[model samples]
Target: MTYCVGVMLESGMIFASDSRTHAGVDNFASFCKLNLFERAGDRVIVLLSSGNLGGTQAVISILRQNGKRPDCPSLWNAESMFDVALLVSDAMRLVDRRDGQHLKKNNNGFHASFILGGQIRGEPPRLFRIYAEGNFIEAGDQTPYFQTGETKYGKPIIDWAITRSTTLNDATKCVLVSFESTMRSNLSVGMPIDLICYKLDSFAVTMRRRFDPDDAYFTTLGKEWSAGTREVFGRLPDLDW
Candidate 1:
Protein backbone atom coordinates (compact mmCIF):
# COMPACT_ATOMS: atom_id res chain seq x y z
CA MET A 1 0.00 0.00 0.00
CA THR A 2 0.92 3.66 -0.41
CA TYR A 3 -0.42 7.16 0.14
CA CYS A 4 -0.91 9.87 -2.46
CA VAL A 5 -2.69 13.20 -2.06
CA GLY A 6 -3.45 16.27 -4.16
CA VAL A 7 -4.93 19.65 -3.34
CA MET A 8 -6.48 22.04 -5.88
CA LEU A 9 -6.66 25.55 -4.51
CA GLU A 10 -7.31 29.07 -5.73
CA SER A 11 -3.65 29.82 -6.37
CA GLY A 12 -2.77 26.46 -7.98
CA MET A 13 -2.28 22.90 -6.87
CA ILE A 14 -0.06 20.83 -4.58
CA PHE A 15 0.75 17.12 -4.82
CA ALA A 16 2.60 14.63 -2.57
CA SER A 17 3.11 10.89 -2.45
CA ASP A 18 5.05 8.37 -0.40
CA SER A 19 7.46 5.95 -2.05
CA ARG A 20 6.68 2.80 -0.10
CA THR A 21 5.21 -0.29 -1.69
CA HIS A 22 4.74 -3.48 0.26
CA ALA A 23 3.87 -6.95 -0.94
CA GLY A 24 4.51 -8.31 2.55
CA VAL A 25 6.63 -7.60 5.63
CA ASP A 26 9.77 -8.87 3.94
CA ASN A 27 8.87 -7.71 0.45
CA PHE A 28 8.63 -3.96 1.08
CA ALA A 29 10.25 -1.59 -1.37
CA SER A 30 10.26 2.04 -2.42
CA PHE A 31 8.87 3.13 -5.78
CA CYS A 32 8.02 6.64 -6.86
CA LYS A 33 4.31 7.26 -6.89
CA LEU A 34 4.46 10.74 -8.36
CA ASN A 35 4.70 11.22 -12.13
CA LEU A 36 4.92 14.47 -14.01
CA PHE A 37 4.49 15.65 -17.58
CA GLU A 38 5.45 19.17 -18.57
CA ARG A 39 5.60 21.11 -21.81
CA ALA A 40 6.91 24.54 -20.95
CA GLY A 41 4.43 27.33 -21.64
CA ASP A 42 1.94 24.72 -22.81
CA ARG A 43 0.95 22.47 -19.91
CA VAL A 44 1.96 20.83 -16.63
CA ILE A 45 0.44 17.65 -15.29
CA VAL A 46 1.11 15.53 -12.21
CA LEU A 47 -0.15 12.05 -11.54
CA LEU A 48 -0.20 10.50 -8.02
CA SER A 49 -0.77 6.78 -8.05
CA SER A 50 -1.67 4.13 -5.47
CA GLY A 51 -2.61 0.43 -5.51
CA ASN A 52 -1.15 -2.22 -7.83
CA LEU A 53 2.26 -0.76 -8.63
CA GLY A 54 2.65 -2.80 -11.78
CA GLY A 55 -0.67 -1.70 -13.24
CA THR A 56 -0.19 1.97 -12.48
CA GLN A 57 3.35 1.95 -13.84
CA ALA A 58 2.15 0.28 -17.02
CA VAL A 59 -0.59 2.88 -17.48
CA ILE A 60 1.86 5.74 -16.96
CA SER A 61 4.30 4.20 -19.42
CA ILE A 62 1.55 3.94 -22.00
CA LEU A 63 0.64 7.62 -21.54
CA ARG A 64 4.22 8.80 -21.78
CA GLN A 65 5.01 6.69 -24.85
CA ASN A 66 1.86 7.43 -26.82
CA GLY A 67 1.18 10.99 -25.73
CA LYS A 68 1.86 12.20 -29.25
CA ARG A 69 -0.27 9.63 -31.03
CA PRO A 70 -2.71 11.62 -33.15
CA ASP A 71 -5.68 9.36 -32.49
CA CYS A 72 -4.75 8.69 -28.89
CA PRO A 73 -6.40 10.98 -26.33
CA SER A 74 -3.12 11.68 -24.63
CA LEU A 75 -2.60 14.18 -21.83
CA TRP A 76 -0.62 16.52 -24.06
CA ASN A 77 -3.33 16.62 -26.70
CA ALA A 78 -6.43 16.63 -24.53
CA GLU A 79 -8.45 19.83 -24.84
CA SER A 80 -9.14 20.18 -21.14
CA MET A 81 -8.02 18.69 -17.85
CA PHE A 82 -11.24 16.76 -17.83
CA ASP A 83 -10.38 15.26 -21.16
CA VAL A 84 -6.95 14.38 -19.85
CA ALA A 85 -8.61 12.59 -16.97
CA LEU A 86 -10.78 10.65 -19.37
CA LEU A 87 -7.71 9.58 -21.27
CA VAL A 88 -6.11 8.41 -18.02
CA SER A 89 -9.21 6.52 -17.06
CA ASP A 90 -9.32 4.93 -20.47
CA ALA A 91 -5.75 3.84 -20.00
CA MET A 92 -6.71 2.27 -16.70
CA ARG A 93 -9.54 0.36 -18.36
CA LEU A 94 -7.30 -0.83 -21.15
CA VAL A 95 -4.72 -2.14 -18.69
CA ASP A 96 -7.44 -3.81 -16.68
CA ARG A 97 -8.77 -5.53 -19.76
CA ARG A 98 -5.33 -6.93 -20.47
CA ASP A 99 -4.37 -8.02 -16.96
CA GLY A 100 -7.46 -8.19 -14.77
CA GLN A 101 -8.33 -11.77 -15.53
CA HIS A 102 -4.86 -13.09 -14.90
CA LEU A 103 -4.58 -11.25 -11.59
CA LYS A 104 -8.05 -12.36 -10.52
CA LYS A 105 -7.36 -15.95 -11.38
CA ASN A 106 -4.58 -15.74 -8.83
CA ASN A 107 -7.02 -14.22 -6.29
CA ASN A 108 -5.86 -10.66 -6.69
CA GLY A 109 -8.17 -7.99 -8.09
CA PHE A 110 -7.13 -5.28 -10.52
CA HIS A 111 -6.73 -2.65 -7.81
CA ALA A 112 -5.31 0.70 -8.82
CA SER A 113 -6.23 4.36 -8.36
CA PHE A 114 -4.76 7.71 -9.34
CA ILE A 115 -4.97 11.36 -8.49
CA LEU A 116 -4.57 13.44 -11.69
CA GLY A 117 -3.93 17.16 -11.33
CA GLY A 118 -2.68 19.84 -13.71
CA GLN A 119 -3.47 22.62 -16.17
CA ILE A 120 -3.51 23.07 -19.90
CA ARG A 121 -3.03 26.17 -22.08
CA GLY A 122 -6.53 27.59 -21.84
CA GLU A 123 -8.01 25.84 -18.84
CA PRO A 124 -7.56 26.48 -15.14
CA PRO A 125 -5.83 23.95 -12.91
CA ARG A 126 -7.91 20.95 -11.95
CA LEU A 127 -7.61 17.80 -9.83
CA PHE A 128 -9.28 14.43 -10.20
CA ARG A 129 -9.43 11.01 -8.56
CA ILE A 130 -9.56 8.09 -10.98
CA TYR A 131 -10.54 4.61 -9.79
CA ALA A 132 -9.68 1.22 -11.20
CA GLU A 133 -13.00 1.03 -13.02
CA GLY A 134 -11.96 3.81 -15.43
CA ASN A 135 -14.21 6.51 -13.98
CA PHE A 136 -13.24 9.73 -12.22
CA ILE A 137 -14.51 12.70 -10.23
CA GLU A 138 -13.09 16.19 -10.21
CA ALA A 139 -12.23 18.33 -7.22
CA GLY A 140 -14.64 21.21 -6.87
CA ASP A 141 -15.22 24.27 -4.69
CA GLN A 142 -16.67 22.14 -1.93
CA THR A 143 -14.28 19.28 -2.48
CA PRO A 144 -10.92 20.69 -3.51
CA TYR A 145 -8.70 17.76 -2.65
CA PHE A 146 -8.28 14.06 -3.47
CA GLN A 147 -6.49 11.16 -1.78
CA THR A 148 -5.63 7.65 -2.90
CA GLY A 149 -4.44 4.74 -0.74
CA GLU A 150 -3.93 4.86 3.02
CA THR A 151 -5.97 8.06 2.91
CA LYS A 152 -7.85 8.01 6.16
CA TYR A 153 -4.91 8.86 8.41
CA GLY A 154 -4.07 12.09 6.60
CA LYS A 155 -7.52 13.34 5.63
CA PRO A 156 -8.47 15.24 8.76
CA ILE A 157 -5.86 17.95 8.38
CA ILE A 158 -6.82 18.70 4.77
CA ASP A 159 -10.48 18.54 5.65
CA TRP A 160 -9.92 21.16 8.32
CA ALA A 161 -7.41 23.45 6.65
CA ILE A 162 -7.55 23.24 2.85
CA THR A 163 -9.71 25.65 0.90
CA ARG A 164 -10.14 27.11 -2.56
CA SER A 165 -8.38 30.24 -1.39
CA THR A 166 -5.36 28.43 0.03
CA THR A 167 -2.05 29.75 -1.26
CA LEU A 168 0.40 27.52 -3.05
CA ASN A 169 2.89 27.67 -0.20
CA ASP A 170 0.26 26.99 2.43
CA ALA A 171 -1.11 24.12 0.40
CA THR A 172 2.36 22.65 0.13
CA LYS A 173 2.83 22.94 3.86
CA CYS A 174 -0.53 21.33 4.47
CA VAL A 175 0.36 18.39 2.26
CA LEU A 176 3.64 17.96 4.08
CA VAL A 177 1.77 17.89 7.33
CA SER A 178 -0.66 15.40 5.86
CA PHE A 179 2.20 13.26 4.65
CA GLU A 180 3.84 13.38 8.06
CA SER A 181 0.59 12.40 9.70
CA THR A 182 0.15 9.44 7.37
CA MET A 183 3.72 8.27 7.78
CA ARG A 184 3.37 8.30 11.55
CA SER A 185 0.25 6.18 11.58
CA ASN A 186 0.96 3.69 8.82
CA LEU A 187 3.95 1.40 8.47
CA SER A 188 3.29 0.69 4.81
CA VAL A 189 3.88 4.35 3.83
CA GLY A 190 7.35 5.82 4.12
CA MET A 191 9.74 8.36 2.68
CA PRO A 192 11.38 9.77 0.72
CA ILE A 193 8.39 11.78 -0.45
CA ASP A 194 7.82 13.52 -3.79
CA LEU A 195 6.25 16.97 -3.84
CA ILE A 196 5.21 19.29 -6.64
CA CYS A 197 3.60 22.69 -6.74
CA TYR A 198 2.12 24.39 -9.80
CA LYS A 199 1.07 28.00 -9.92
CA LEU A 200 -2.02 29.11 -11.81
CA ASP A 201 -1.50 30.33 -15.39
CA SER A 202 2.16 29.35 -15.20
CA PHE A 203 1.75 26.20 -17.32
CA ALA A 204 4.77 24.75 -15.57
CA VAL A 205 5.70 23.23 -12.30
CA THR A 206 6.78 25.97 -9.92
CA MET A 207 8.40 23.77 -7.32
CA ARG A 208 9.41 20.15 -6.99
CA ARG A 209 11.39 18.26 -4.37
CA ARG A 210 12.11 14.87 -2.96
CA PHE A 211 12.21 14.75 0.84
CA ASP A 212 14.46 12.06 2.26
CA PRO A 213 14.30 10.76 5.82
CA ASP A 214 16.84 13.29 7.08
CA ASP A 215 15.76 16.39 5.16
CA ALA A 216 16.20 19.22 7.63
CA TYR A 217 13.18 21.23 6.54
CA PHE A 218 10.82 18.27 6.71
CA THR A 219 12.23 17.12 10.03
CA THR A 220 11.82 20.58 11.51
CA LEU A 221 8.31 20.94 10.17
CA GLY A 222 7.31 17.55 11.52
CA LYS A 223 8.61 18.38 14.98
CA GLU A 224 6.95 21.78 14.96
CA TRP A 225 3.62 20.34 13.90
CA SER A 226 3.77 17.71 16.58
CA ALA A 227 4.59 20.28 19.27
CA GLY A 228 1.79 22.51 18.07
CA THR A 229 -0.67 19.62 18.16
CA ARG A 230 0.35 18.76 21.67
CA GLU A 231 0.01 22.37 22.73
CA VAL A 232 -3.45 22.55 21.21
CA PHE A 233 -4.53 19.35 22.86
CA GLY A 234 -3.32 20.57 26.23
CA ARG A 235 -5.31 23.78 25.89
CA LEU A 236 -8.58 22.03 25.21
CA PRO A 237 -10.87 22.16 28.26
CA ASP A 238 -11.18 18.88 30.07
CA LEU A 239 -14.57 17.13 30.06
CA ASP A 240 -14.08 15.71 33.55
CA TRP A 241 -16.76 17.72 35.24
Candidate 2:
Protein backbone atom coordinates (compact mmCIF):
# COMPACT_ATOMS: atom_id res chain seq x y z
CA MET A 1 0.00 0.00 0.00
CA THR A 2 0.88 3.69 -0.11
CA TYR A 3 -0.21 7.11 1.02
CA CYS A 4 -0.39 10.08 -1.33
CA VAL A 5 -1.93 13.48 -0.61
CA GLY A 6 -2.31 16.84 -2.31
CA VAL A 7 -3.32 20.13 -0.71
CA MET A 8 -4.56 23.09 -2.74
CA LEU A 9 -4.26 26.39 -0.98
CA GLU A 10 -4.68 30.04 -1.89
CA SER A 11 -0.92 30.39 -1.80
CA GLY A 12 -0.24 27.35 -3.99
CA MET A 13 -0.26 23.54 -3.87
CA ILE A 14 1.51 20.83 -1.90
CA PHE A 15 2.00 17.17 -2.93
CA ALA A 16 3.36 14.20 -1.03
CA SER A 17 3.63 10.42 -1.27
CA ASP A 18 5.15 7.47 0.56
CA SER A 19 7.29 4.96 -1.37
CA ARG A 20 6.57 1.55 0.13
CA THR A 21 5.00 -1.38 -1.71
CA HIS A 22 4.57 -4.73 -0.01
CA ALA A 23 3.34 -8.05 -1.36
CA GLY A 24 3.54 -9.71 2.08
CA VAL A 25 5.16 -9.18 5.43
CA ASP A 26 8.34 -10.81 4.15
CA ASN A 27 8.32 -9.12 0.73
CA PHE A 28 8.65 -5.38 0.64
CA ALA A 29 10.11 -2.85 -1.80
CA SER A 30 10.30 0.86 -2.44
CA PHE A 31 9.50 2.63 -5.68
CA CYS A 32 8.82 6.31 -6.23
CA LYS A 33 5.12 6.98 -6.40
CA LEU A 34 5.54 10.62 -7.34
CA ASN A 35 6.01 11.74 -10.96
CA LEU A 36 6.75 15.29 -11.98
CA PHE A 37 6.56 16.86 -15.41
CA GLU A 38 8.04 20.31 -15.30
CA ARG A 39 8.71 22.84 -17.99
CA ALA A 40 10.60 25.02 -15.50
CA GLY A 41 9.14 28.49 -15.85
CA ASP A 42 6.33 27.38 -18.09
CA ARG A 43 4.49 24.62 -16.20
CA VAL A 44 4.78 22.10 -13.41
CA ILE A 45 2.69 18.95 -13.17
CA VAL A 46 2.83 16.49 -10.31
CA LEU A 47 1.22 13.09 -9.95
CA LEU A 48 0.85 11.15 -6.70
CA SER A 49 -0.33 7.57 -7.01
CA SER A 50 -1.72 4.77 -4.86
CA GLY A 51 -3.10 1.19 -5.19
CA ASN A 52 -1.69 -1.74 -7.20
CA LEU A 53 1.90 -0.93 -8.10
CA GLY A 54 1.78 -2.62 -11.46
CA GLY A 55 -1.41 -0.90 -12.49
CA THR A 56 -0.28 2.55 -11.35
CA GLN A 57 3.12 2.17 -13.02
CA ALA A 58 1.50 1.00 -16.20
CA VAL A 59 -0.71 4.07 -16.38
CA ILE A 60 2.20 6.39 -15.74
CA SER A 61 4.31 4.62 -18.34
CA ILE A 62 1.56 4.99 -20.88
CA LEU A 63 1.33 8.72 -20.20
CA ARG A 64 5.06 9.19 -20.68
CA GLN A 65 5.41 6.93 -23.69
CA ASN A 66 2.41 8.10 -25.67
CA GLY A 67 1.98 11.64 -24.42
CA LYS A 68 0.61 12.80 -27.75
CA ARG A 69 -2.32 10.43 -28.20
CA PRO A 70 -5.00 12.37 -30.02
CA ASP A 71 -7.88 10.37 -28.67
CA CYS A 72 -6.62 10.25 -25.08
CA PRO A 73 -5.45 13.90 -24.60
CA SER A 74 -1.97 13.31 -23.22
CA LEU A 75 -0.42 15.50 -20.52
CA TRP A 76 2.17 17.17 -22.71
CA ASN A 77 -0.49 18.67 -24.93
CA ALA A 78 -3.00 19.45 -22.18
CA GLU A 79 -3.91 23.13 -22.12
CA SER A 80 -4.81 23.36 -18.44
CA MET A 81 -4.59 21.38 -15.24
CA PHE A 82 -8.20 20.35 -15.75
CA ASP A 83 -7.31 18.95 -19.14
CA VAL A 84 -4.40 17.15 -17.55
CA ALA A 85 -6.81 15.51 -15.14
CA LEU A 86 -8.91 14.35 -18.09
CA LEU A 87 -5.83 12.95 -19.77
CA VAL A 88 -4.80 11.08 -16.63
CA SER A 89 -8.28 9.75 -16.14
CA ASP A 90 -8.25 8.53 -19.74
CA ALA A 91 -4.95 6.79 -19.10
CA MET A 92 -6.33 5.07 -15.99
CA ARG A 93 -9.39 3.86 -17.88
CA LEU A 94 -7.24 2.53 -20.70
CA VAL A 95 -5.12 0.59 -18.26
CA ASP A 96 -8.22 -0.84 -16.62
CA ARG A 97 -9.68 -1.83 -19.97
CA ARG A 98 -6.56 -3.75 -20.92
CA ASP A 99 -5.81 -5.47 -17.61
CA GLY A 100 -8.96 -5.43 -15.49
CA GLN A 101 -10.39 -8.66 -16.85
CA HIS A 102 -7.16 -10.60 -16.45
CA LEU A 103 -6.67 -9.38 -12.89
CA LYS A 104 -10.28 -10.09 -11.93
CA LYS A 105 -10.12 -13.65 -13.28
CA ASN A 106 -7.24 -14.31 -10.91
CA ASN A 107 -9.24 -12.83 -7.97
CA ASN A 108 -7.24 -9.62 -8.11
CA GLY A 109 -8.50 -6.22 -9.24
CA PHE A 110 -7.03 -3.43 -11.29
CA HIS A 111 -7.10 -0.90 -8.50
CA ALA A 112 -5.36 2.44 -8.83
CA SER A 113 -5.94 6.14 -8.10
CA PHE A 114 -3.98 9.35 -8.53
CA ILE A 115 -3.71 12.91 -7.33
CA LEU A 116 -2.90 15.27 -10.22
CA GLY A 117 -1.86 18.77 -9.14
CA GLY A 118 -0.04 21.57 -10.92
CA GLN A 119 -0.27 24.76 -12.90
CA ILE A 120 -0.01 25.53 -16.59
CA ARG A 121 1.45 28.81 -17.84
CA GLY A 122 -1.73 30.87 -17.95
CA GLU A 123 -3.93 29.09 -15.44
CA PRO A 124 -4.18 29.00 -11.66
CA PRO A 125 -2.75 26.05 -9.76
CA ARG A 126 -5.29 23.26 -9.56
CA LEU A 127 -5.52 19.78 -8.03
CA PHE A 128 -7.58 16.69 -8.83
CA ARG A 129 -8.08 13.17 -7.52
CA ILE A 130 -8.40 10.78 -10.44
CA TYR A 131 -10.24 7.58 -9.69
CA ALA A 132 -9.82 4.12 -11.22
CA GLU A 133 -12.77 4.58 -13.58
CA GLY A 134 -11.51 7.60 -15.49
CA ASN A 135 -13.39 10.08 -13.36
CA PHE A 136 -12.02 12.81 -11.08
CA ILE A 137 -12.87 15.59 -8.63
CA GLU A 138 -11.07 18.85 -8.13
CA ALA A 139 -10.15 20.55 -4.87
CA GLY A 140 -12.06 23.68 -3.97
CA ASP A 141 -12.43 26.13 -1.10
CA GLN A 142 -14.40 23.88 1.26
CA THR A 143 -12.54 20.73 0.30
CA PRO A 144 -9.03 21.92 -0.30
CA TYR A 145 -7.29 18.57 -0.10
CA PHE A 146 -7.37 15.06 -1.56
CA GLN A 147 -5.80 11.83 -0.26
CA THR A 148 -5.41 8.25 -1.49
CA GLY A 149 -4.15 4.98 0.03
CA GLU A 150 -4.14 4.39 3.78
CA THR A 151 -5.78 7.82 3.98
CA LYS A 152 -7.78 7.28 7.14
CA TYR A 153 -4.72 7.11 9.39
CA GLY A 154 -3.54 10.58 8.49
CA LYS A 155 -6.60 12.54 7.41
CA PRO A 156 -7.65 13.96 10.75
CA ILE A 157 -4.56 16.10 11.21
CA ILE A 158 -4.89 17.57 7.75
CA ASP A 159 -8.54 18.23 8.34
CA TRP A 160 -7.69 20.10 11.50
CA ALA A 161 -4.70 22.05 10.22
CA ILE A 162 -4.88 22.70 6.47
CA THR A 163 -6.64 25.78 5.15
CA ARG A 164 -6.88 27.91 2.04
CA SER A 165 -4.65 30.47 3.67
CA THR A 166 -1.95 27.97 4.59
CA THR A 167 1.51 29.11 3.50
CA LEU A 168 3.70 26.92 1.37
CA ASN A 169 6.15 26.33 4.22
CA ASP A 170 3.41 25.51 6.72
CA ALA A 171 1.68 23.30 4.21
CA THR A 172 4.85 21.29 3.84
CA LYS A 173 5.04 20.96 7.62
CA CYS A 174 1.45 19.77 7.80
CA VAL A 175 1.93 17.21 5.02
CA LEU A 176 5.01 15.83 6.75
CA VAL A 177 3.05 15.54 9.97
CA SER A 178 0.31 13.73 8.07
CA PHE A 179 2.88 11.35 6.63
CA GLU A 180 4.39 10.76 10.07
CA SER A 181 0.96 9.93 11.43
CA THR A 182 0.37 7.37 8.66
CA MET A 183 3.78 5.74 9.09
CA ARG A 184 3.10 5.25 12.80
CA SER A 185 -0.28 3.60 12.27
CA ASN A 186 0.42 1.53 9.13
CA LEU A 187 3.49 -0.52 8.34
CA SER A 188 2.57 -0.72 4.66
CA VAL A 189 3.07 3.03 4.25
CA GLY A 190 6.80 3.31 4.86
CA MET A 191 9.03 6.26 3.99
CA PRO A 192 11.17 8.03 1.99
CA ILE A 193 8.42 10.47 1.18
CA ASP A 194 8.43 12.67 -1.91
CA LEU A 195 7.30 16.25 -1.32
CA ILE A 196 6.66 19.04 -3.84
CA CYS A 197 5.48 22.58 -3.20
CA TYR A 198 4.34 25.06 -5.82
CA LYS A 199 3.83 28.72 -5.23
CA LEU A 200 0.91 30.47 -6.86
CA ASP A 201 1.26 31.94 -10.37
CA SER A 202 4.94 31.05 -10.54
CA PHE A 203 4.18 28.30 -12.99
CA ALA A 204 6.97 26.32 -11.40
CA VAL A 205 7.65 24.21 -8.37
CA THR A 206 9.09 26.14 -5.47
CA MET A 207 10.37 23.29 -3.35
CA ARG A 208 10.83 19.54 -3.55
CA ARG A 209 12.34 17.22 -0.97
CA ARG A 210 12.71 13.57 -0.18
CA PHE A 211 12.19 12.73 3.48
CA ASP A 212 13.70 9.43 4.55
CA PRO A 213 13.49 7.81 8.00
CA ASP A 214 16.68 9.51 9.11
CA ASP A 215 15.99 12.99 7.75
CA ALA A 216 16.65 15.42 10.61
CA TYR A 217 13.58 17.61 10.15
CA PHE A 218 11.25 14.66 9.76
CA THR A 219 12.76 13.02 12.86
CA THR A 220 12.32 16.19 14.86
CA LEU A 221 8.78 16.73 13.65
CA GLY A 222 7.84 13.15 14.43
CA LYS A 223 9.09 13.39 17.98
CA GLU A 224 7.57 16.80 18.62
CA TRP A 225 4.23 15.95 17.06
CA SER A 226 3.89 12.70 19.01
CA ALA A 227 4.75 14.42 22.27
CA GLY A 228 2.37 17.25 21.50
CA THR A 229 -0.46 14.87 20.75
CA ARG A 230 0.08 13.01 24.00
CA GLU A 231 0.20 16.25 25.92
CA VAL A 232 -2.99 17.48 24.31
CA PHE A 233 -4.70 14.20 25.06
CA GLY A 234 -3.74 14.39 28.69
CA ARG A 235 -4.94 17.96 29.00
CA LEU A 236 -8.41 17.23 27.65
CA PRO A 237 -11.20 16.81 30.24
CA ASP A 238 -11.91 13.20 31.12
CA LEU A 239 -15.31 11.80 30.17
CA ASP A 240 -17.89 11.48 32.90
CA TRP A 241 -18.86 7.93 33.76
lDDT of each: 0.89, 0.89
Best by TM-score: 1
> Candidate 1 — which residues are off by over 4 angstroms?
234-240
How do the residues 10-91 of candidate 1 rate in per-residue lDDT, one tens digit apiece?
8888889999999887889889999999999999999999999889999999999788687766887888889888888888
Reference-based lDDT, residue 20, model 2: 96
Question: Which residue pairs does candidate 2 place in steric collision?
Answer: none
Tens digit of lDDT per residue, candidate 2, span 184-203?
Answer: 98999998999988888887
Q: Candidate 2 local accuracy as lDDT?
A: 0.89
